[model samples]
Target: MNEVGVIDWGIVGAGHIAHRFAQGLAHVRDARLARVWSRRTESVAAFVQRHGGEGCGSFDDLLASDIDAVYIATLNDSHAGYARAALAAGKHVLCEKPATLNAGELRAVLETARVSRRLFMEAMKPPFFPLYRTLCEHLRRDPIGPVGLVRAGCSVANVPAEHPSFSLDTGGGALLDIGVYEMFLAVDWLGAPLDVQTFGRIGASGVDTFASVHSRHEAGIAQLFCGLDLDGKGDALLAGPHGYVWIHEKWWNPVRATVSYAGGRVVELNVPFEGGGLNYETAHFCELIRAGELESPIMTHEKSLRMISMLDAARSALGLVFPGE
Candidate 1:
């Protein structure tokens, strides 16, 4: 509601992603945390006290506050519900990714946003970063010629089942938790694949511990894998008829990439981020809110839905299902 200044915002969760979102907001001069809310009263109180934010009694109370936007950092299952509530209450929403478990849930959230005439964005975070922007530009310029093949994977090891990250009920798994990032980056950069094949290891709890998926497109093909059982590395390589461009540490935060072209000519590109690389998205959200845009053209509702659809297909192929899916 504050015109000519930073937008007032309420943070809906006080978890790790909430912390990072708050930290990222710090880099933006035109956004202010108006309130903080969490079911855990003590946690919300602590977060408010540390960040100098007012403590709202409940998430509903936070929505009732005179805030322009609500950042939903809750669990995967709670994303749609929270976003729906916020949109209905006439507040813009920027939720952390997989924004919803499946395409249907995502569509429901987007429809709510449409009816309420409020903005809704998935906080995929990495795509809005400087590194991705640079990559997009380079690829558009055909810096590496036509891409031939791309190999992308995201993996981590030794995650305990007790952690909420491993919980199948709230939509936890290797592919959903981390693989989505790889899939998003691949599809975002290369467009939808003509066909996709998946293979992976599922845990006893009915969660995917490891997954390998091959995506074939008209231009080229991408091979993607993700898992928790084995300690693996995540990287994205855009190979062309002549050579390839390698994105180092691709999935989460890509800071550097090496481009190798014909005659073995190699060039290393570095993404020098000013802040946490989160500022780019934070700034983008603020800009969209100011402009009264309901969805980002780059990360549109359709894009989010399509990506989740792919995830659902992969899960189905793996015969993996969360508790109530």
Candidate 2:
């Protein structure tokens, strides 16, 4: 409850991503870690001890604490529930990607946030980064000279059965976990597609292990693939008549890019930063909350809903049905 000149933040869920967000907070001038809450009391206590913050025993206590915002880093299934509770309690919210299990859930959360007049934003990570902004600018300048096709993919070794990434009931799958990155970029660059065709191979747990999707935009097309059954270096390419931009390891905080064209010409761009790239999203969240804005022009609510709808269609095409849904 101390009056610091920064946005007081309480982090919910003590996971790997939560730690990254905490570390990223050090670089954000307008936000500070005020408290932490987790089902594992001892773990939350340890997090507070190490991070110089307080540990609360329950979500009620954390929400009632002197924090301006609640960062929900819990499992995907828990996002909507926690965010709704936070918004109802008069607090801003920054939730992790796949903010909800489906478009319906996203709609429900947005409706609740709207009714409560509170700010709610998803932590998609890439759109808020500097490199993506720069890339958008170049593309707008016709650097690519009329994009013809976009091919993007993200695939990694399957998670162990014990890992949360393998749980279907918790909304675990390549699409929500990693495919959204490629999908978001495609939509951001080319807008919604006229049609979407998808093919996926589901795991024994009823989650899609691999998905190959084609989005046909009016102007061009986006060919995207994501999987847990294969391991390959991920890249996103925006191709055009004149040149193409290549983003390496595009999903996990891209640091370098290459633009290549005919005549063996290549231009490499380096994205510089002071600390962890996670600062981008956190900083953007602070700005929006400080300005009393509910929606972001860059990462709009409509975009989130549309992306979820695409996933819904893809699931229907692949015959994927979550448990108890």
Candidate 3:
């Protein structure tokens, strides 16, 4: 950060999620994408042209640039490497999703952040959304008692077989690509997983096509699922002794929810988001940068590790292992 309090950002990938980040950055105050790098020069050029950032020829160039933070928006397998490199370069890292392939890899990445004394966070966007925030506050004022059971899942059949999400070499699977989100919700609400029981199918691409996971957490139990070749669907439920909260379809990107009480009263929450929804997390990251914080209170390192550990266990149960893991 300069004297003006502006945070210069470097992006490691120029894919769909990166584009969403660039769009969301416009809404964050005093944060700008100063540099961007990807595997393809043409993709970098196109991204820079639209997002107004300097195109770097290599990942090293992006790291060497005078940027305050690096957003790792690459594929699942490469997230750990980019995060480690950026943090070692003395740059704060906001990695997309699962953070790393497994618990061991995430532990290594977290250690790097500690040694480098830089902020590191996984870009989990749900809890930062307006509706989620509202739900928390509402539950705090009223009483939902202790949330014990969380049920959430998402499945989609629109993705073609050629999509990177089904490629084994890239570490793409419904478990990591889609189930990670559900895992986050489970851990966030129910606590760390105690045991994960999974059943799924492996596709011809050598990745998981679908998975149904039943996890017992410290607080309660959660039932979650994810799929790449199924119909597009989902909703989430948080059940407690008093009542339950129902997050409408596509709960991960939640906008509306219904809170019911045992007293026969219902509360509806609807808080629409702006800037394509990624801005909430990006803005939170910027706030962390300005505060000189090493970790986010909401999306803590422990929560990330717990989420990935569930993914690891689920994958192991289904006999779905990546190439190098």
Candidate 4:
């Protein structure tokens, strides 16, 4: 942090998602973009010009800068390595979702955070949204009786073959890329699953282009569908014995939701925001650093481990294995 109390942030990637994240930083008053590093010099230069940051010649240069934390927006397979490096450099780490390729890699990163005594978090944005918090409060009050089923899906049209998300070596798949959002909502709301089943359509690249998962929780069941080869309705529903909650289109980053009782009583909510939804997570990360916290209570390490474990189980059931896994 500088003398003005602004936490300097170094970005580790210059991809599309990284651009979204940089845009999000504009809404966080306590944080400032400090440096950016990417293999592509032109990409990094453009990112800095738009986001008010300097372009580092290399990842090492970014780590050596006067930054309080590093926001890693790298490809799926590179998440663990960059996170470990940033932590070792004594900078807090905020890595994007699917924090690691598997539970084993996640464990290694967690161990590094412990040894380094630095804050580490998986940048799962949905859980940090105000709408999600409100829904959680309603669920706590049992406004929907006991939730018995959760149905959620997130899908998008396929990208070009050259995109990293389409390559198995880069940890590309519908599950790890988009499906984790659905999985997070289910696990966070329903707890760990006792039984898991999955089926997937593998593309020529040995990645799951489409996948469906069923997880049996103690109190209910969660049904999830995700794909990269097609488009979906992008919605989610939580139905209980006496009522249900409906998250509007693009449920993962929704701005609205509705709750209805069996008797026909209904209530709707609108969650307004500035910039992209990524701001919520960015602000929360800065808050944690200001408080000298090593982990986020909302997105705890155990929660990340559990999420990845479920992903691993589902992938195994579908016979979807990444390269060198």
lDDT of each: 0.82, 0.83, 0.93, 0.89
TM-score of each: 0.95, 0.94, 0.99, 0.96
Off by over 4 Å in 2: 1-5, 262-264
Worst window of 10 by summed lDDT in candidate 1: 139-148
Residue-level lDDT of model 1, residues 1-325, one tens digit each, is: 7768679989988998888778778888878888999989999988977776799998888888899999998888788899999999999998888899888889999999999999999888777878778877876775667665878886778777686667788898887788888777667756776777899877877688888988776566778888888888777877877778888875468789888887888877798677666678778988998887889988877678767877888898988776656
Worst 10 residues of 4 by lDDT: 138-147
Residue 76, candidate 1: alpha-carbon lDDT: 88
**Which residue pairs in candidate 3 collide?**
none
Writing each residue's lDDT as its tens digit, candidate 4 over 265-295 gives: 8989788666788999989999999999999
Q: How do the residues 1-325 of candidate 3 rate in per-residue lDDT, one tens digit apiece?
A: 7647899999999999999999999999899989999999999999999999899999999898899999999998999999999999999999999799899999999999999999999999999999999998999999789999999999999998789998899899999999999999999999989999999999998999999999999999999999998985689999999999999987988899999999999999999999999999989998988898999999999999999899999999999888888
Clashes of 1: 2
Each candidate's clash count: 2, 0, 0, 0
Best model per lDDT: 3
- At residue 202, give the lDDT of candidate 3: 97
Look at candidate 1 and tell me the lDDT of residue 322. 68
* Sequence-dependent TM-score of model 1: 0.95
Ten contiguous residues with the weakest lDDT in model 2: 135-144
What shift in Å separates residue 47 of candidate 2 from its native position after superposition? 1.5
